[model samples]
Target: MSAPRIIQVASGKGGVGKTWLSITLAEALAEMNRSVLLFDGDLGLANVDVQLGLSPKHDLGSVIAGRARLDEAITKYEIPSVSGAGGGARFDVLAGKSGSGVLSALTKAEISGITRGLKVLSDRYAHIVVDLAAGLDQGVMSLCMPGSTTLVVVTDEPTSLTDAYAFIKLLSIQEPAADIRIVVNMANDREHAWRTHAALTNACKNFLGLNPPLAGFVPRDDLVRDAIRHQTPILFRHPQAKASEAVRRLANDLLLPVPRPATIISTSSRK
Candidate 1:
């Protein structure tokens, strides 16, 4: 089978709704009939399991400790169709080690091992959404594959814009032709979203000599909080919610073909 598209969702700092976007995006992709796996790549301080209300028998901790195979750690999450149809979206989640800081202290070799495992597991799914830890730490950057599409989530906050610029700058240094895209979350409206994008775009173009295209924007919605509290995806619990609609649009945009660099590094090439 062909390798699955890896969507690495990242942010400069926390509390920017990065994890929520990762979960909803995975669900949206699955709804489009693609096999999806949401890999909680946050490692230490992971909360994907908490957000999804799942208690898996195996997790990344088990895999890292050699107690379980990578595939064995996967937990299936299904969302029944809101229309009461028998068929709905189903996806797998390779949860991270929650409420523990041990994974954060992993050695470089250990981090590479997990990346290798993910590459092997890529063959089983059509797309893998990796929820990266917030920041530019070594652990977070190590998992950022060159062939993956990097989505940097940002808000209108000044700190968010500044830190996002720092991240984009460093990522560009690592991979000059990296496919970095901006995702504006919790915007007031389309105009607000574009303005936010323009702010980041201007900074990148002026300083980094690059202009990362705007992937999409998600408007602020109160229902999102409710879905989080319920440990269910907004697309599943409130399909008609504004946030759900925006996420579906983002997912659809990702499905469209785009030019990629010829020097794109596949997982097999990683040492």
Candidate 2:
């Protein structure tokens, strides 16, 4: 049997730490001896490479451009979670490619190739966390649509809240019943974070008739900033810190047992 694919982490606005969450979750899952693949699906402004401080020999853009094969473009990084956190398995990353000019339009054949590669990787990896670009791009939406779980990360600010609502609204229109998850980052405390979530949930219910699940809340901490500056995850840099502990708990809750689809049977099968 293939490994389980649960969630794909994303955000409405940029610079809200969605990428950081993705990296942390990947390491978190890997620490549990679960195979994790962190795919940089955010085509524009891809920074998984920058976050890890590793210069990739190739990137997904190259694969999309037909300039490099998928295997050749993928790079592996050694990310450490908390001490005695878990078994500490390995993590693979598909960095986003950078380019300009009229690259070949992503054709049907190319899309199929990419999807096939992702399915193969998903079969082996315990978790496939796709880091989508902020905003509502059709390409990003297509990639995010297949995810059985979706995480929407936001900050406790007016603009962040607005964007969060906009993102949820768009997704609800596209996939009305999608199980959207919410994460309020940079909060002063749990209460403040929950308030932000309440506002978001209320908006979703009032307008879109949906209530997104609260995946987790991360507190604002100097440790998070410090780790970012040092080019390491907070879990590794300050494992004992409160913010780090919260993130660890977030990861555990996500990786914990949950009911999944009984089978891959399609709508046509029921007929």
Candidate 3:
């Protein structure tokens, strides 16, 4: 069988560190000798290229403009290691169209093309992690369908909680097959993060009849902001930090095999 192709990380609100986590997870998978490709699915607010500190000659713009095919627009990153020997995962980014207009509005044919492109990359790599745009944007949702594992990120605040629920609710209605993965960022501890997820999941189950799964949680840490300012991922900057550990654990958790849930979802958990 082909190497496990699973997971696509997203959040209801921006600045929830989705991009950072995607980059870090890519690195983590690479460290484990698992080839990974971090797809910049956030066509509108594409920043995975910046986070990697590399400027590509082309982006998804080339593909959308029809000037270049999907294969031509692809960029590769050869991330060097700390030791003299350097090897890292190859990052393929789809940085959206250059113009503001809805370039290549994800038609079924185009969507199939993109998914096939990702599979091609996955054949060479073990995991393909997509960094989605914040909120329930159409461009984001179109790619994060029920067939894909959707990781919804949130914070401990009330606004984040409510927004997380709303985001999942919207998605659950549009894509019933979507497996919701919850990860609470900027939490004080695992318990706090779990509480945040429980609240949001309960609300989704109660009102929308959707039961999202608990994937992982990332704690609050100053080092995350520091790494972002430095244009480096926390996993590379401070792997020992609480948040870093959480992200590492998250990578493993996401990699774990999750059996498909039965169609029936309990109403008690919905509320």
Candidate 4:
């Protein structure tokens, strides 16, 4: 079987809606008939399960601690059809143990183990969406392989732009040929989104000499906040919401053929 498309969603800072985008993007891809697994790569303080209102008995910590197999920790989430039809969207989630501190002290060997597990699991699904931890920490940098697409989520704030540049600068140095793309979340409009994208891209072009293209942008929508508050995916909670529509478009763009071969991360080599 062919290798799965590994899309790593990351950000320079927290509170930029990185996890939310990751969840919805996975759902959107699932809706397109591709089997997807949303792996919460935020090892230190994961909240993907909490945001989705899931109470999984097993999590990443279980696998790391030898309490369960990697596959055993997976929790399946399904959205029933509103019209009572048989068809609906569903995807699997490999949740992380929130506030467990297991990730904080994880050795390189343990990280490599998780990376190998993901490679083994790649055969079963067409896509693996890894929502990485915020900032350019070891956890985030280790998982950013060369062959996978990396979507850097940023907002209109100056701080967001600065930190995003820092991430891109480092990633470009580490994986010079990495497929890095920009995603503007909480944008005011298309124009506003482009401006935000330009700020990051210009900085990259000038300093890093690399211009990451814009993957897409999500508009600032109140419904997004409501969905997060209720621990429901925006696509399921408000299918007609602007944010939901934007995510669908982003997913569609991602479905296009990747320009490079798919490869897993080598955490051991990341210094």
TM-score, per-candidate, Cα-based: 0.92, 0.84, 0.84, 0.91
Candidate 2 lDDT, 91-169, residue by residue in tens: 8888886443222245545555666788777776778888877877665566654545778899977778888888777
Candidate 3 minimal-lDDT segment of 10 residues? 84-93
Please say which candidate is ahead in lDDT: 1 or 2: 1
**Native-structure RMSD, model 4:** 4.8
| Whole-model Cα lDDT of every candidate shown, in order | 0.88, 0.73, 0.70, 0.85
User: In candidate 3, residue 107 scores what lDDT?
Assistant: 70
lDDT, ranked from best to worst: 1, 4, 2, 3
lDDT by residue (25-74, candidate 3, tens digit) is: 77777767776667777766677877766676777767756777766766
What lDDT tens digits, residue by residue, belong to model 1 across residues 144-247?
88878889999999999988988887888788778888999999999999999999988777667777888899999999999999888889899999999999
The top-ranked prediction according to TM-score is 1
Q: Which regions in candidate 3 have their CA more than 4 angstroms from the true location?
A: 1-4, 80-113, 261-271
lDDT of 2: 0.73
Predicted structure 4, TM vs. truth: 0.91
* Candidate 2 weakest lDDT stretch, 10 residues: 262-271
